[model samples]
Target: MRAAVVISPLASAVLAGCVVSQTQGGAEHLAAPDGAVYEGVDTRLLDGELVNFVVAMRGARGPDDVTAYAECAAAQYALIRGYGFARQVRTTVDEKNGAWTGDAVYTISPALPRGTRTIDAEVVVAACRENGIPTV
Candidate 1:
């Protein structure tokens, strides 16, 4: 003989709540609690294919936010120059008084740049727009 078990409605509701909370909380969440303010992006052409991007913003969670801003600028710049890809050379980030700045250098090329940090101009620009980050 086997015994049957049953769950009450209240118990099932509590179990569903636990699942909901678990899905809502995790390390992948990086959005700012308050709204972020994007100051602007300054772009400079350093050489034939090398470019510099300076981005400023407020309410950044960390360096990653500023870095993304620079990347967005580079991606749009590459697309505007009729290039399909960009390779990140370097990025420097600083924060002061709740304001953040990122200085980044990238090389734009018609082909995929020779680097591990290469970005597809179209894809990155689309993602930036989806994330509410402005592009150059």
Candidate 2:
């Protein structure tokens, strides 16, 4: 002789909920394949010819995306200030709650700055616009 076991409908529903909830609140669920979503840029003049840019975004693949956003802002800011070039000083990137932020600094000059990371303001701004990154 054999005994048969049965699960009630209510118990089955509770078991299903437990399995589904295990995959929630993970980084993979927050990431998007369509690419990063640019948020905004904030440019501040720290000193004469020295500018600081704070940029934020979502769905960034890594720190590179955040850095690029900050660089784009610095380039546009240089042009707005009547400068033709900018040299990257440094950039600090951070991620929290699936949002990325970059704090970058650059020096603007009318002449091409003496650095390997120098950027032509006009060229950078054009690229930024093409790439759909916001600038200040």
Candidate achieving the largest lDDT: 1
**Model 1 agreement with the true structure over 1-136: per-residue lDDT tens digits:** 7433222111222334421111221111222225899999999999999999999999887776677778778889999999988888888999989989999999999987564567778876765665576888
User: TM-score for every candidate vs. truth?
Assistant: 0.76, 0.72
Worst 10 residues of 2 by lDDT: 19-28
Q: lDDT score, residue 24, model 1?
A: 22
| Model 2 steric clash pairs | none
User: In candidate 1, which residue ranges exceed 4 Å CA deviation?
Assistant: 1-33
Residues 15-128, model 2: lDDT tens digits: 344211112211111112257788888878899999989988998877766776777788788888899888888889899999999899999999877755677777666655
